[model samples]
Target: MASSGSAEVERDLTRDIRLEVSSSNRSSCQVCKEKIEKDSIRVAHPSRSSNVSIMKYVHPSCYLSSCVHFENSKCKSKCRLSKHEIGKHELRLTMALTSCEGKLKDQVFFHPPHASTLVRQLLDAAGGTEHTFDQLCVSLPQDAKAWARDALSGVDLTGRRAPTVEPEVKPRAPKKKRAAEDDEAESAAKKPRAKKAKASSEYFVEDGDPFCDGDQNDGDAELVD
Candidate 1:
C-alpha cells in the first residue's frame, strides 16, 4: 500500500510545471539550442527519471516540438483534460490578463528589467488602482499557481543562471567639423580677384584690350587646358 502511494505521489510530482518568459540571458533553450532572451516566453517541465526533481526549459512555441506528447495520450484517448492542457490554458489566461495591463501601460507586453515573467506579470497586473488583480492571482488554478511559484522561486537543476548578452557597441568615426571649416576658409581664400579693380586708372594706363597681353595669354592658355 505504501509503495503504491509512493508511485502515485511520484506520478503526481512529475508533471510539467509552468510557462514563463525568461528575464535573464543566462540560459539557452533545450529544444532549439538558442539563447532565450529577456522578455521572450518559455516553458518548464519536471523530469521524472531522477529522484531529485530537475526542470527542463524551452521556448513557448517550441513546446509542441520539444515534448513528444505535450498532452497526455491517456487523457486524449479517454477524452479527458490533462495537466499540460490545463496548465497552458491557465497560462494563456494569465497572459491575456497581463496583456490587459500591458495595454493600459501602452506597451505590447508588460516587461520588467531583470525580472521573470511571473513577477513582471504579477506586478503589472496588480499595480493599478484595483485589488481585483490580487484576487485574480488568488483565483488561479493550483497547477497554474505552482508554475508561477516554481518560476519565481528560481529553482533549477543547475545552480547557475544564463549569462547576460551584452549589447555590441561599434565605435563611430569622428565628424570633422574642422575639416569642413578649413575647406570653407580655403575656398574663401581662393576667391576670384576683385574683378581686376575695373582696370584702375591709378594702377595702369588704358590699353586697347580690356586685359593686358600677359592676362590675355593666361586666359588663352586656360581655355586651351
Candidate 2:
C-alpha cells in the first residue's frame, strides 16, 4: 500500500497543465503584480485546493526559476533544466500559441505555457491601427517576433479582426494671399493721385490782376486829357 501511494504521488508530481494568458484584464500576477508591460508575454499556472482550481500568472523566466531553486554550501549554485525538458516545454508553448488564436480555449487540454500570452502581446502590437504583420514584426524583440511569424506562417490572417482606429480630420488653416498681390495692393493705397486744375470761370472775382487795373487807369487819363 505504501509503494502504491508513492507511485501515485510520483504521477501527481509529474502532472502539470500548460500555462496560458488571462483572457481579460481582470487578474494580475501574484508574484510580480503584473509589472509585465504591454506587448510582453505572461504565464498562468493552475493550482487546486479542496477540488477548486485557481490560476495565477507569472513571467516565463520567473516560472522556470521557481522550478529550479537550489541551495547548497558548494558554490551556492542553481540547477538548470536539461535540453529535453526545455524542448518539451518549448514545444508545448509553441503549440499553445499557434492553435489557440491568442487565447486559451480550454483548461483541461494543455499546449504550451504562456503561448496565448505571447500571441496576445503580438496582437496588441499589430492591433487598432493599419499596421500589417510585417510592419509589426520588426518592432518586437528578436525572439518574440520570430516566434510570432513562425506561429502565423501556416495560418491565414486575411479574416483576422483588429481594433479599429477612428480617422481624425484636422481643420486646415486659412490660406494667405501671395506676397506679390499684397505688395501691389499696399503700394496702390500708399501712392498720392494727381488732382485736375480748376477752370478760370469757376474762380470768384474777389481779387483782379494789376494789368487789368492799369488798362482802366490809362483809359480814364485819355478821357481827362
Candidate 3:
C-alpha cells in the first residue's frame, strides 16, 4: 500500500509538471515576473478549472524555491492593473482566500512582481504586525516546505511592482470598405476625357484655304490677283 501511494504521487507530479525550451518570448515567468526569452529553459505547470486547462510557466530557479501548493499559475481573467488579458499560457501568481470557516472563497491572480506589492498593501492595512511573509508561507500546504523557504530567502516583499504592459493591437480597415474605395479610384481613372467644344465664332482653317498662312491684307492681294 505504501509503495502504491508513492507511485501515485509520482504519477501525479509527472502529469502536472514538465520542463521545456520556450518556443517564444511571449510568456513571462510567474516567479520572477519577467519574460522567459525564446529558446530558454522553462517549467510548465498545467492547471485545470471549469474544464479549461491553462499552462503556467516559470523559471527553473523560481520553481525550486516556491511552495508547491502556491506554484505559479496562468492568469484566468483580465488583469486588474493592466485592464487587459494577461494572455493564455502567461505566467501569474495565485492568491487564494478562504472564509472564516476555512471554506475556499476566491482566488486572485497577479503578475509575480505585482503579487509582492499586494502583499505589502495587505500587511499595511492590517497594521503591518498582524502577518509576516514567513507566517503566510507557513499557512500554505507544506508539500515543498524546504523549497518554499528557499524561494523566499532573498525575495524583496517591498520591491516596486513592475508595470503591466498592454498588448499592441493595430486597427485594420474593413475589407469591404477598402475594396469600395479602391473601386472608386479605379473607375475615376478609367473615365474617358470629354472633348472640348468649339465656340460659335470659331471655324477650322482647311489645309489649302487662302487665309490659312497669311495676313488678311495678303489674302486680299491674292484674291485680287
Candidate 3 stretches greater than 4 Å from native: 1-14, 69-225
| Candidate 3 lDDT by residue in tens digits, 1-225 | 569889987755553345678999999986678999999877676655587756677665555344222433333465444445555444444543333475533344544544455444344433435355565566444543433333334355354332233346799867998899999999999999899987698677977687686444553454543
Give stretches of model 2 more than 4 Å off: 1-15, 35-40, 65-67, 70-225
The residue pairs that clash in candidate 2, if any, are 19-113, 92-112, 93-112
Candidate 3 pairs with clashing backbones: none
lDDT string for model 1 (71-101, tens) is: 1112112111122332211132212111223
Task: Sort by lDDT, best first.
Answer: 3, 1, 2
RMSD of 3: 17.0
lDDT value, residue 128 of candidate 2: 51
Q: Lowest summed lDDT over 10 consecutive residues: which window, candidate 3? A: 67-76
lDDT against the true structure, per candidate, is 0.43, 0.41, 0.55
- Residue 194 in candidate 2 has what lDDT? 82
Candidate 2: tens digits of C-alpha lDDT, residues 1-225: 469889987655443433445466656644445665444456655555577755555555544333211111121111121122322112222211111244432223212222344344444532454433444345444545544444334344344331122335799755566767888999999999888987676544433676343334454455544
